[model samples]
Target: MTDFQAIGASRKTANTMELIASAARRTVKAAIPAVPGGIIRTGRNAWRSGKASKVAFLVDGAAYFSALDQALRQARQTIWIVGWDFNPDIRLRPKQSSETLGELLLSLADENPALQIRILVWGMGPVYSGKSLRLFRESGFSSHPQITMRFDLRHPLRGCHHQKLVSIDDSLGLLGGIDLTARRWDEPDHRVSNPVRRSPDGTPYEPVHDMQSMVSGQAASLIGDVARRRWKKATGQKIEPSPVRDAAWPLAVAAEMTDATAAIALTEPGLIGKRGHYEAFRLTRDAIRAARKHIYIETQYLASFGVARELAKRLKEIEGPEIAVLVTKSSHGLIEKLTMGNNRDRLIRRLKRIDRYDRLRVMYAVVPDERGGEKEIVIHSKLMIVDDAFIRIGSSNLNNRSEGLDTECDLAIEAETEGHRQAITALRHRLIAEHLDAAPEDVRQMESEKRSLLETIEVLNCRERGLRHFAVDIAHGGTTPLPGTAIVDPRRPYWPLHRLRLRVGRLVSVFF
Candidate 1:
């Protein structure tokens, strides 16, 4: 009996120790900022004309990896890759078929000897864990010379490392919606006949539309700093500063200003460790407040608690600028369509209540020519164009997760000069033009005619069903219990008590 009591006491003590350790780990992780300090700022006339920094745009996985490969090949010192997901098996250039990302990093480490490669990826669900996690662990454990990979699990409940960014040697940086993985491959032409793609098995995957940015000068350095801080939080290691080079890209850079100025915006839950990063939400709020003419946005989801309120207020103010939003018609999965989609519709109705359904327009991107008969084109790019001057791109969806429940990093550039503003406007035109399979000039002409983006889309949508109608149907296709209110906490039990709570929450979300 005494031995049994001793054993039970020992077990309790061990459990207490384990809990303490877990709490300590969480505390350390929470200390890390969802949006690092000195990353973003908002002000009146932020986009006013002046001599400012030069910015470039790089989109999708292929373009980003290509730019990284080039920058790494030329790097004199450091490389940083931050992402929600990173696949080691993914060949940066699968068409080249010469090297995988891991091999490339290994070779870089071997050749440079002094160069450091830091990879920060989300510590997502175990089911999503792939070869990258294993390779990262093995490399660290085996004491592989120069490459370092760390998993970011900073936010305990709702946070995720959703930023997709890469700074190469501190000289060049890439930012945007594209993650380094399969199923993300589309060209500027957006051809349907024969598109480039790669499957998990290295076969042909379907085409996807996405965007990214390539930045040089101080912007690159800024991104490098952001990456370093995230790395430190993840691994408790300090990174040395990497300086930028003066080399120029042959292609024209977007947001090329005469002045060297820009800002970085971050998004996550409300609080680090306690909640998530809401940096994106904060940035959007500030941007909306500052807008003078028009606020154009492209995002995956638009169902945030704070954001919806802000939009309603702005739309009702009557003094604020008009707003246009672009989002996916529906999530790819039916379950998401049922849950998230329903929530989105409720949010939309709320926005309409404020704007009286006039100052707001929401549209979805559709593959203009679906010769292959694909039912829908998934809209994945998270971007915003405000007053034809401010541009933002990142991984944050405009939802609860982005507001205060998930990790996200976004880049924002204000076109301070006419040339820079025009360039940014042209890029927006180009993106819309690509989706519509029309020329940029045509898009510009349509916009000049004072057509809502949805109206322009309707005109361009070749299908007899039409774009606006399609968007409406897609937005409406969900179980109408309450839109944007179903909170699925998978950890809960399958008992009737839990189901009752869920049903109650569903009903309450609709009214609240």
Candidate 2:
């Protein structure tokens, strides 16, 4: 019986490998119609405008809550939210209202007779355990006539809905790492020592630092399409196009901008039930491959072996562009630090080996205080800027779980014109400025002093070490020495238990 089982396992492995090979060949042969040069040139022309199509940023919990309230109020026809976790009992504005998310959603449904609300959440995770699912059912969302909520179980046995986005009436959208849950609220100040935070039950919660973005125009419409498709997949219902009506929300268009083009990128496994469309991941690879000057990447995790290999390949070419990566240092809670922090170490080791020119540098963002104490500001923003001509912001992290196991959505804008390029550059400076609590102009001046924007801030902030810096150093320094390969070898004897734990972790990562 054992011999028979061994033979069966070997056959299964061979079959899987053959399937993967076939998929690869099909992907290579697939024809992605070339985007016309005229369109590309038009986008290039729009880069001259020194303004983004639409710009809004959300920091901490207050910002997230405010953005959600404003989006719901402004939505005329539809409201769609996708999340890794969704707690109906959590209040959007605990300080102002005692109503939980469920009540608030029901109220929206009651008020907007013509509006449709759809909520998609991860189906198999701690957040969606049996009891939690019961809570969801007990919440008004399950019975609300105008609201539709469903658990997204699209992937194999272990996969998750990890995107956090809210689209309103096809006119406005919010995307980033911020989730609508408890313990996610805090002010931009990120008062570390302060003991004042409001939870849904009026209990105090700890402060957290995070970021999200609000967008409008064509970009919003594109994101809405993504939401609609996912909704259909989960609920088997097609969304009727509901044109945007309310104009009260701030939606700005660049005045002097010219020739700017924006596109959305998504990432998923190679094959999904037949016809191929890993367009998002492919676009990301192509963007990296095409970079001529520099690439600035910001993500929550950096554990994708495939991405690391691609980066190493680019770095090895010598003539390729410089690459800079910004990730969270180790200050996460015990469990998170053990899992994500361990992956960070493995990633750093892989990067070090591939960095032949010493051009690649990884750093953590720190939030400093007046008296010299600092804290590691968690980098929840998923952003990548290439040569000031392209920028991407969304919920996708740079981890194996994100790439192959979980669902994600990202927004990308290419500024081909000088004005648009300048606008994007200014936005990048603004993000850096907010992180440093410095004026935008000050951040801009510091930009030229160092090789990368992250380094510039680190140098300028040398004198202002506080809880933030201490946390960053401690977190980054504590990781075991990196291994040599882009792909972590769980079998290696010297590899830390954390690394081995990650191998065990793969079982659940599909739903993480």
Which candidate achieves the best TM-score against the true structure? 1
How many clashes show up per model?
24, 30
Candidate 1 TM-score, true structure as reference: 0.75
Superposed Cα deviation of residue 108, candidate 1 (Å): 2.2
Cα lDDT, model 2, residue 298? 75
RMSD of 2: 13.1
Expressed as tens digits, the lDDT of each residue in 110-132 for candidate 1 is 88877777777776622365454
lDDT score, candidate 2: 0.60
- What is the lDDT for 244 in model 2? 62
The C-alpha local distance difference test score for the whole of candidate 1 amounts to 0.60
lDDT of 2 by residue, 1-512 (tens): 33223433554454445554644454342223223332122222121112224656565567777667756766668888888777676767666777777787788788879878888776654254334656555745676778876766554334456778888887777787877765677777666555446555566644456667676666666667778887775555688666663434543322323333456555443223343234445545656765666788778776556677667656654445677677777544664555567666665666655444445656666655557766666666677777787776677777655654456766666766687788777776766666666667877787776645545555444434212321232223433424432233121112343345334434433432
lDDT of each: 0.60, 0.60
